[model samples]
Target: MKFQLDEQQGGNAISRHDGQCVWVNGQPHRASLLVPWRGEVQPWPLSRFEDLTEAHFEQILACKPELVVFGSGARIRFARPQLYRSLIQARIGVETMDLGAACRTYNVLASEGRAVLAALLIDPE
Candidate 1:
């Protein structure tokens, strides 16, 4: 689906998302990715939820976001707290949801100028 928000809001907001792909600032991205409120949109190297590792969460620390929205593919699946213990230690909040919801939530927080990141997992086609 597509999303509408003021372009002037000034942040890396999710512009569209569907079963197959996600668009960041109108650029289509088919792989899993990281969308920060403001900064580069990173490609997350995770293709399956089951393959998640602690190092995945650790990599996010470089962005130092206040919160992270984890999109666990097409369904809402929670990762074990231990996998993200690093984030907990850093006091960064993490929320898990289906891919679509994560996109929407990330957009809202990004538009509000919150330091948020969307760590989305998209299975390879």
Candidate 2:
């Protein structure tokens, strides 16, 4: 599905549903669906992260965010150097932290209206 972002609500604004997956803007996202997102919980119908490709990164780049946060599941040092370099070359800052910290940081920056995109991974059970 197509995902449309609600720019006015900011990052704290998340769409939530009961059993159905949450859609961010209009596109189905699974960033928060795989776990309990404490902030603005939303339904993301997508099943896997592999579906998120370089095109997704390009779209996010359009946001002209100051920083991009990647939540690599529960691991602290699982960052993709190539992706990180790409963002840096575009003048965007990148941070690879655990999912929990990434969520908290994303909310804070999002609320502040900072251009920040969070690519969070699901915690393995």
Candidate 3:
């Protein structure tokens, strides 16, 4: 689906997303990645939700986002707290949802100028 957000001065906003791809700044990306409100979009290097590890959360920790919106592929699946223990310890909030919701939520927070990150896992078809 396509999205229309009041363009913020500078930040990465998700313009569209579907089952297989997500559009960031009008560019389509078909792999798992980390999208911060500002700065370069980095590849997450994860193929599936089942393969998630704490190390993955650690990567996010380094980004220092106030919150993380984790899209668990095509479905809404919650990861175990243990998987993201480090984040909780750091007081960084994390929310999980299906791919579509994650994309939408990320756009909203980003547009509002909040420090948020979208950790999307786009499973291969």
Candidate 4:
């Protein structure tokens, strides 16, 4: 007998992750990327979490997701709330976590059919 997992049914899932890279759908992605639950994974120019600004957040907001899962590099980091003021105004939710944790959370949320976007900032080894 076989059990079918929710994430295996055509939804994008994080297949693996490590200190230097993350694998989405079994492909290794070394740089930062924006992974939407139902669309393409786009490259995010900002390499580090500290480089995040209002403009960066605005670009993610343009994707029109109900919530954003922010993977703040190798270790958990918090951003200034003012930087994401537009999201708050738009009533979009943002959750911060380390890259590994964020990846796991994104898989679960996407499997549940939530309109979520994982904004991951990968740090170099």
Q: Quote the RMSD, in angstroms, for model 2.
A: 8.9
lDDT of 2 at 89: 80
Model 1 / residue 15 / CA error / Å: 1.0
TM-score for candidate 3, please give it: 0.93
Q: Please write out the lDDT profile of model 1 over residues 1-125, one tens digit for every residue.
A: 73555572668867788867999989999998999898899988898889999989988888999999999989899999999999999999999999999998988888777899999999753
- What is residue 79's positional error in candidate 3, in angstroms? 0.7
lDDT string, candidate 4, 1-125, tens digits? 73337345766788889967889888899999999897788888888777889998998999999999999988899999999999999999999999999998998888888999999998773
lDDT computed for candidate 3:
0.92
Candidate number that wins on TM-score, 1 or 4? 1
Rank ordering of all candidates by lDDT, starting from the highest: 3, 1, 4, 2
Q: What value does the lDDT take at residue 112 in candidate 2?
A: 65
TM-score of each: 0.92, 0.55, 0.93, 0.91
Candidate 1, TM-score vs. the true structure? 0.92
- The positional error of residue 30 in candidate 2, measured at the CA in angstroms, is 4.2
Q: Whose TM-score is greatest here? A: 3
Query: Please, what are the lDDT tens digits per residue for candidate 3 over residues 1-125?
Result: 73555566789988889879898888899899999999999999899888999999999999999999999999898999999999999999999999999998998889888999999999964
TM-score, ranked from best to worst: 3, 1, 4, 2
Q: Where in model 4 is the C-alpha error above 4 Å?
A: 1-7
lDDT of 2 by residue, 11-111 (tens): 34334322223344345554444212123333333334445455445554555667877665555654455544556689887777865676556656766
